[model samples]
Target: MRLEGRTAVITGGTRGLGRAIAEAFLAEGASVVAAARNPYDIKELADDHEGRLLYQYTDVTDERSVEELMTAACEAYGGVDILVNNAGVSRDGKIARLSVADWNTTLATNLTGVFLCTRAVIGPMTTPGKPAGPGGRIINVSSCVAGRAAVGAGAYSASKAAVEMFTRTSAVELAPKNIRVNCLSPGYIDEGMGKELAANERAWESYRGRLLSDRLGRPEEVGAAAVFLAGGESSYVNGTVVEVNGGLLWAA
Candidate 1:
């Protein structure tokens, strides 16, 4: 197992992409804490995984909640070896008609949430005498929309783009402590937001041809990339954006 005995904390891990990452980590022998505001059928996962899985009530946008989540993970597994900032929300609106409330909600959950969770994990991950081997790993979940332009997605795009930059800056700042920060940018997948978007015929038509693959990506594929980033396989990889978009081409 590449992550044998490691411990990871994943925000928004109760379902969708985050849950997939949790499963992958567990398979690699890493104890996982899936942090989210709701359990959302996670107990079933816990039942299946046994002692290796836990679900923590965490509001990534709340500093206190994020802190408590880190504390809980450490209490459960001794220390945290990885932190995946995957909790996010997307509010679709064109720039011209975007509401202030919507913008705030999007940025708070998507951008600020990442910042809070990452900041809260520093202590647990860096403290010596803990079991975190070879330092720490921070995986920030970005999206294909961060790099691609789309109508009525200004807020969503901007938040994710900012997350990419934040990942780079954090990678540099935390490298000396042996922590590697990286971004996972996933494209349309058969789960969560991607699933919803693909359900819309108009949206599907607009994006189908852009992908080299004829179908949406599978959730496990994103999880596979996440496992690579979290485990020793990516030891020398940091401050990089690994896209799991299945080859998307911009319209000419």
Candidate 2:
């Protein structure tokens, strides 16, 4: 177990990519706190993982809630060795048609949430003599749209692009504290938001040819990449955006 004894706090861990990451971490023997606004079926995960898993109700958009999540994780597992800011929301609309409410919602959950969660974990992760490891990991989840443009994705794209920049800046600032920050930019996959897109046959057909793999990416693949970032295997990796997009070509 590469992550044996390590403790990871994952935001939005109740479903989709976050759930996949949680399962992968547990398999590697890490204690996981799955924080989300809703618990959903995470109790089932708790049943399977038992002591190794915790489901904490968290609203990442609220600083207080984020802080409470960190506190709960520490109280339960001692301290956090890894923090995955995987919670996000996408509100798609063309600029002229996009409501201000939609824009605010997207930025609040996608960008501000990452900031709050990262801030909440910094102290515990960097504190001297803490029960956690000497160096901690912070993995921010971004989207492929962060680096590419698509019609109707203005707000989501902008927020994620900002997240990538934030990740780099955080990595530089936290480096001296022995905390490494990185971003994972996932392209269209077969789970989570991508699953919804794939449901629209017209949309799926239009995008399918862009992927060199000729198929949608599996959640497990993303999970494997997350494990590497959270484990010792990525000791030298920091401040980088690892794109998990199966060689996707950006359509002009």
Candidate 3:
């Protein structure tokens, strides 16, 4: 196992893309702390992985809860080796009519949560004598919409766009600490949020033809990409956004 003996804290790891990443990490022999606001039927997953998995209640939007998550990881697994900032929310609305509440909600979770989790993990990950492995990794999840134009996706796009820049900045800042920060941007995937979109026949039809692969991406595909970034094989890779979108050809 490439990730044997390492411990990773994954925010929003309860479902969707986050869950996929958690599964991948577990398969690679890493101890995973699946941080999410709700348990969301994770009992079975925890049962399967047993000691390798932990479900911690974390509200990434709140500083206290995020800190507690780190503490929990440290207590349960000795220290944090990798962090996947996969927690996010999307609020769709045209620019003019978007409510302030919606905008704030989007930014608070998508942007601020990434910041909080990244900052909180620094202590545990870098602390001496507490590492499960060569500890230092952070993966931020963004979306293709961040760089493209999508009608009624102003707030959502803007928040993710900000995350991409944040990822770059964090990579530079955390370099001296030996932490490699990177971004994973997935396009139309048939899971979680993407699944919801693909459910809309009209929307799916429009997006389907634009994809070079001509099909929705699978969750395991995104999981595989995450595995590369978290593993030692990508030791030289950092501060880059790896697109997991099945060759999505979208300008808007």
Candidate 4:
């Protein structure tokens, strides 16, 4: 119960890495609000965790929707002590083939959403008198591809690279407010996008050699890293990008 009594708001917490992080936080005794455009069977999670979990419909790209999410979280669990900007979308296409729409959508969700959600949570997390305890935590989710170049990952990679820089900037600005911000850059995992990639034998074989572990990472592994970042264990850690990859070797 490292997170006992803490309140966390996770964007896109209904599935994939976000869902895994939600479950991990709940296990550590945190009250969580999972925000996404759709519930996507998150009711099952609510049922299992009962009072500890709440699902809110949120479109992170919209400012009003994000404000409502933070407001609702405050009303339900008092105030948010931790925030995870985990919402993202991937529209893979080569530079020449990628459409403006695909690039726009990818940036809107992957980069802009993080900006909005983080901005909205600042006030609540740093309420003058309330003082959310020792301090607040903000975890921005990035991808391993942020620093690696791939054939059809232009938009996704660009958006994520910007996110990592944004994480650093946020950390610097929010440090005075006692808010610690960090980025979690996950490598190919066994679920979500990684699962889709692994399904393609040719793609999997090509990328398999890059992983030092010689296997895809587990969702729980990413979730565990999230827990560490949000918990007291990482009090001194901030403005750093924690790579949860199984040691991916990128070619020059």
Candidate 5:
């Protein structure tokens, strides 16, 4: 139980990578606060695991909503020890044909959401009388597209890139407070953000040949890496980007 007695909040934890992270944390003995817009089916999940889990409907893009999420999490769990910013979206279109509304929306949810969640939780992570741990962890879930100038994903890519920069900035600022900030940028994962690409059988076959692992990574693998970042294993690791791309983005 690497995270025994820790309290964690994961945005977008109702599904995909976020959901997997919540499960992983719970398995590691952490009490989790899962926040997302979707109302969670708590009964089924609670039955599956004999551990503590709370869900709050949250729009991460909204400051007030994010603040309320933090308040509820801290009140319920005592304090926040780890935060995983995993709320994001994608809108694919050519640059010439892209709509400003779509671009702004992507930035709002992907980038601004991270900022809102981080800001809302930072105080609890830093303030005293909170029983989280000796230090705190903030892991921003980014994408491999942030490192590559791939075609047809300008808005999504740029938003993720900005998130990385934000991560570095947060690490530098929060270091004095004993909180570490890092980014996890996965490449062509089989579940979560890459589901659309993986849904195409032909695309998976072609993609398998390119990947060093000969297959797309799974959401649980990302969850495992996230656990490492959140636990004491990554104590000295700070202001860095962990590439969970399975050699697909060797350039990163």
Candidate 6:
């Protein structure tokens, strides 16, 4: 088991890629604390994983709630060994037509939330503090659109771009303390959340041509990358953005 005695805190872990990552961690023998705003199907997760899992209702946009999430994880497993800041939202609109609320909401959840969650866990995850183990890990979920100029994704692109930058800066700052930080940017993932945008066959066909990969990426593929990055196999890796887009945005 790559994470035999680790404890992981994953934000936005109720569903989708986050849920898949949480399960992957559990499979690797890590105790996981999955956090989101809404109550989750903990009974099901608990039934499968038993004492190795926990669920917390966390609002990443709020500092107090984020702190509470980290505190709960420490209380449960002594300290956090891994932190996944994966909570994000998209507000799609052209820059000229975008409202302030739309931009703020996107930035808050995608960029600011990551900062809050990282800050909440840094003291406990680093070496020069009252921590359980030596050091810990951090993974920020980014997007391929961050560097790409998508027409209707101004707010989302900007927010993810911030996430990427923050990932690099945080990694550099935390490296001395033995804490690793990295980013995972996924592209054209086959998930229900974006189904409404490409609802029609014609729209999907048009979008499909742009992708180098023939099919959309599966959620499990992203989860696999997360597992690798969160594990000891990636000890020398830091400030890197692992693209799990099936080679769609190769250069970016």
Per-candidate local distance difference test? 0.92, 0.92, 0.91, 0.94, 0.88, 0.86
TM-score of every model versus the real structure: 0.97, 0.97, 0.96, 0.97, 0.94, 0.93
lDDT per residue for candidate 4 within 1-252, as digits (tens), equals: 999999999999999999999999999999999999988998998898889999999999999999999999999998999999999998988899899999999999999999999999999988878854769999999999899888899999999999999999999999999999999999999998899989999989998988888899999999999999999999999999999999895422
Error of 1 at 199 (Å): 2.1
**Tens digits of per-residue lDDT for model 2, 45-122:** 989988999999999999899999999998998888999999999889999999999999999999999999998898
- Between candidates 3 and 4, the one scoring higher on TM-score is 4
Clashing pairs in model 3? Answer: none
Candidate 6, residues 1-252, lDDT tens digits: the string is 888899999999878788888888888899999999864675598679888889999999999999899889988988889999999998889989999999999999999999999888887686355544536899999998888898989999999999999999999998877899999998878775545535778878877766777678888888889989998789888999998876766533
What is model 2's C-alpha RMSD? 1.4
- The worst-scoring run of ten residues by lDDT in candidate 1 lies at 243-252
Q: Once superposed on the true structure, which residue ranges of model 6 sit more than 4 Å away at CA? A: 127-134, 194-199, 250-252
- Lowest summed lDDT across 10 adjacent residues in model 3 is found at 126-135
Residue 244 Cα positional deviation in candidate 2, in Å, after optimal superposition: 0.5
lDDT, candidate 2, equals: 0.92
Clashing pairs in 5: none
Q: Give the alpha carbon lDDT tens digit for every residue of 60-138 in model 3.
A: 9999999999999999998898899999998889999999999999999999999999999999888976644444989
Residue 45 deviation, candidate 2, in Å? 0.9
Q: For residue 150, what is the lDDT in candidate 1?
A: 84
RMSD of each: 1.3, 1.4, 1.5, 1.2, 1.8, 2.1
Candidate 4 Cα deviation (angstroms), residue 114:
0.5
> 1 or 5: which has the higher TM-score?
1
